[model samples]
Target: MSKICEICGRKPHAGNQISHSAKKSTRWWHPNIQKVRVKLPDGRVKRMKICTRCLKAGKVQKAVS
Candidate 1:
């Protein structure tokens, strides 16, 4: 699964991690993406990778287990 939100288009952000000694280390802030099944406009359920924020915001309807 890709690290992208199908609903909000959220992607991984690059940044640095600062240590106590003022040392900087490169890192990535990846979104909390999950594979889920969403209902499409045509009533077809499709699987996609979406971030937790979008899921919490109800941007897409998750498929019933």
Candidate 2:
């Protein structure tokens, strides 16, 4: 499964990792994605990949049993 936010359409971020010896290596900073049960507009609960930021911002409503 891909680490992408379904609500915000966020993807992984590419960057370089530097060591103490000044050596650079390629690395990716992935977003905090989680599979949450979301409540749709029709009151149906479905699992989706969502990011923490969007969850905190109330972009999607979580289904609570």
Q: CA lDDT, every prediction? A: 0.88, 0.95
Off by over 4 Å in 1: none
Off by over 4 Å in 2: none
| Candidate 1 clash pair list | none
lDDT score, candidate 2: 0.95
Cα RMSD, model 2: 1.0
Query: Model 2: per-residue lDDT, tens digit, 1-65?
Result: 89999988999989999999999999999999999999999999999999999999999999998
Residues 1-65, candidate 1: write the lDDT tens digits: 67988788889889999999999999999899998899887889999998899889888998786
What's model 2's lDDT at 15? 92
